[model samples]
Target chain A: MEESATQPPTAATPSATAAKLAMRHVDFHYGPFRALKDISLDIHDRAITAIIGPSGCGKSTLLRTFNRMNELIPRTRVTGDVLLDGTGIYGPDVDVAVLRKRIGMVFQRPNPFPASIYDNVAIGPRRHGRKEPDVQEIVERSLCRAALWDEVKDGLKGPALALSAGQQQLLCIARALAVEPEAILMDEPCSSLDPAATLEVEELMLELAQEYAIVIVTHNMQQAARVSSMSACMMMDPDRAGVLAEYDATSLIFTNPKDKRTEDYISGRIG
Target chain B: MRMSPRLSQNLARAVIWASAVLVIGLLLFILAFILAKGLPTLSWDFLTQNPSDMGRGGGILSTIASTLFVTLVAVVVATPFGVGTAFYLTEYTREGRMTRFIRFGAESLAAIPSIVYGLFGFIFFVITLKMGWSVLSGGLTLAVMILPTIIRTSEEAIRTVPKMYRDVGFSLGATKWQTIATTVVPSALPGIVTGIILAIGRCVAETAAVILTAGSALQLPTSLFSPARTMAVHFYIMAREGISMERAYGTAALLILLILVINVAVNLLVNRFVAKGR
Candidate 1:
């Protein structure tokens, strides 16, 4: 049920340029059980693409495929092609570590390491063999970019776990940004935050989208509407597999979805 | 009916209190008895001088020195092997036939009695390897005996680390080994060190295996090849052979004090690591 009309350029869409990352007929499975069906989508750079769906619809799974993070699980299998900048990321020669570095991820709950704020941000660069001397500069730039430097600047030596939940999430964002990734994937980054924290993260997402391609999986439709420029709506099929139903500019998808299921889900009539 | 339930609850509380008091009372009684009988024999000469006429007089200086050497060798040899095995079992491999097999082996090793371990060490290290009942032999034997404890406790500690830490590490493009070294091991340090402390306790208190593999020579061992005797074995020989019950009590008291000191030292180290982790 792919919508072809939005595939072409429209005035309302944000820059119908080439996609930075593309998923072509991808399927994912956990052992014998299929989790995501054949799904194809293109994520444009310098824009926030929100993947909104009901629980168990594989929104997070699809997001993880970009970095091949799902392969960490035992007995997990992936089929089809996922390309980053027109290069097949699933190719035999592709280094998984390098791919993940290029596409950073922010988890649902804020998971800063049990370390100093400076150490948490520096850990990525350190692990990737970044020079020690440049780490101070990188940490400052990343924290500054995440909008957390002002609050945490004086306390970089303090433990990251001591921060409030909202601040922790921002610290996580800063941690991800320290790697200097071209794209950032967030899996419900603000679900555990208070309303104020949620607003802070949403605002941060908007600002971050100016430089990095951001793909977010959120259950909150209002959040999808508030932060994203493009949206992909997915639903679970009869076989308990997630399938993408509609993809279009945020305004069009919310106002006049081509698929009835997407409309039903957005209107709160169905899960 | 309500009165009956209340009465039963009160009875349960009384029983619990009595049990707690009973345990504490027994421990205190033992400590008091040991201190009263042993304190009189504890003097500077009693500690610093070599035992005269097979531990009937003089101090346990050689015994103390040997105990330290044997324990040092055991801990140095076992820590790396035990922690490495635990890391492999928990981090590198998933639960399967191989993991189950290794876990079963560890459990079996833990269940074997100390006497059986003593016999095995005597036969293998003393007879087969011809190590000649030296500190090296005793230390190696104790190392084998404590390996299971370290592996089990360390693996449990590793497992207790939140899986999200690994996820975050991997998401940042860290390799498996790097993630484990930086995040998993550091987070699990306090628990791992606790396991090592337990192993140390076992090493200190152990007598049978050490007596078999390392002959109870009263002189200070000058090297790995030199024979040694621990304080526990010295106490055993003195008390069992009717050589000197007074000096035996002194040795027992000193052993208890040594264990207390070691426990306190290890706990402080663990606390520092935990604070740093936070």
Candidate 2:
């Protein structure tokens, strides 16, 4: 582990007015057990932020916190705040459904709805009552953004599940992008893919980073190294409960991190 | 050292599978035998014409008509309440002693024999509330009898949908009911339909409850308030009285055939629905 420079530059850019999401001292608990403690992070307007952690270290949990996905579980409670732009999302007046339209997500496993390829991407806009953006144009645009259009162009009528494993993952990414979300949260979006597929998805993520703020949680140290500009490493404590040990630039976390656990993790000495 | 343990494990599995198949096969065989023996006596007129106590094995048109009415009404009456109760229990309520109690009560109701249900239906419809013996009373009793089956199966189907799918819908800002309506219901459609089919099969064959609640008039009733005889009750009464056994056998055969044809038709219709359903 190196030192403090791994911390992402906290200064505001001129385009920072569009700064997408921030989690503030956000503490999450499942019943009596704390999952994340004092978690504060800024996901800039259009940059790739990678969260690297051992399993059960709260990376996915933290990713879910952004769009309030954790609300599905009973007894799950959040103590701090999550703000999209300057507005507090957890504010009572905020409609959770409308909020999720702006904060879309791609899961670890490819989960395209049991629908046709066309319907899969069309669902969000239709459900949210977007007076149908040229649906053909939007579906193609989103698929192009996720790098899936070319592969699936001719067979849009096929069931989404009929795609190859890699194509399905990209399709899921396209599904997330179709909603025109300001930020896209991915939970190890490439973990299930092979090397070639992973590379394809990684490239897609980097290209997408140019337009949308992307937060990805990955177990692969190399994936974190390859994709994200800012990175945070979470470690599982002796209690087997997880906590964020360090947050920094990807280069710094891998080449020169501040914590020993981060060092052990990146070097493969320990998980 | 490990040889016997491995062999014993395999033996245990074989016994388990064999017993299951044997029991299920035994039931299937009995059903097949009864159906086969009754088939020769079956005819179109036998199903379309009314049975007469005066004649032998003549017709069961009234029985078929009344049975259809009672079962259709019962299903229509019970489905909404059944689905609502299931959704309430599985989606809204937390897993606790109270939910567990309700679930247990439902399971216990499912365990009750048809005879007990008939007794309840008989007293309530005929004696107590005085709805009298009619297709309406029979339908009411069968509706109550079928509730637990529909609720339990629908609940199981709903609960079996992947939690990830639920989370996806919820994260997208869908209300609890919306998520269920759009995603969960579609996914669980096959299982729910399977349960309904099974329940409908039971309802068609059920004689005790229908006999108690629906007075066997042998004539096709014009309204739900009029007394009528279901096919099973007609067979029961005819066979017990030792009158035209061939006609009773034919009536049984015709009813079974009709049910089979109806199921195949319904399954085809349901299967045509696109992904997320059967």
How would you encode candidate 2's per-residue C-alpha lDDT over B136-209 as one tens digit per residue? 88988998899999999999989898987777676555677777887788887877887787778878889998
Q: List ranges where model 2 is wrong by over 4 Å.
A: A1-18, A130-136, A236-242, B1-37, B53-58, B274-278
Q: Once all C-alphas are superposed, what RMSD does model 1 give against the true structure? A: 1.8
- Give the TM-score (vs. native) of candidate 2: 0.90
True contacts kept of each: 0.65, 0.37
Give the per-residue lDDT of model 1 (tens digit) for B199-218: 98998999999999889998
Chain B TM-scores of the candidates:
0.96, 0.87
Worst 10 residues of 2 chain A by lDDT: A3-12
Question: Residue B174 deviation, candidate 1, in Å?
Answer: 0.3
Provide the lowest-lDDT 10-residue window in model 2 chain B. Answer: B269-278
All candidates' TM-scores? 0.97, 0.90
Per-residue lDDT over A166-257 for candidate 2, one digit per residue giving the tens place of the 0 to 100 score: 99899887877777888899999888899999999999988887788889999888888888878888888776556678877677778887
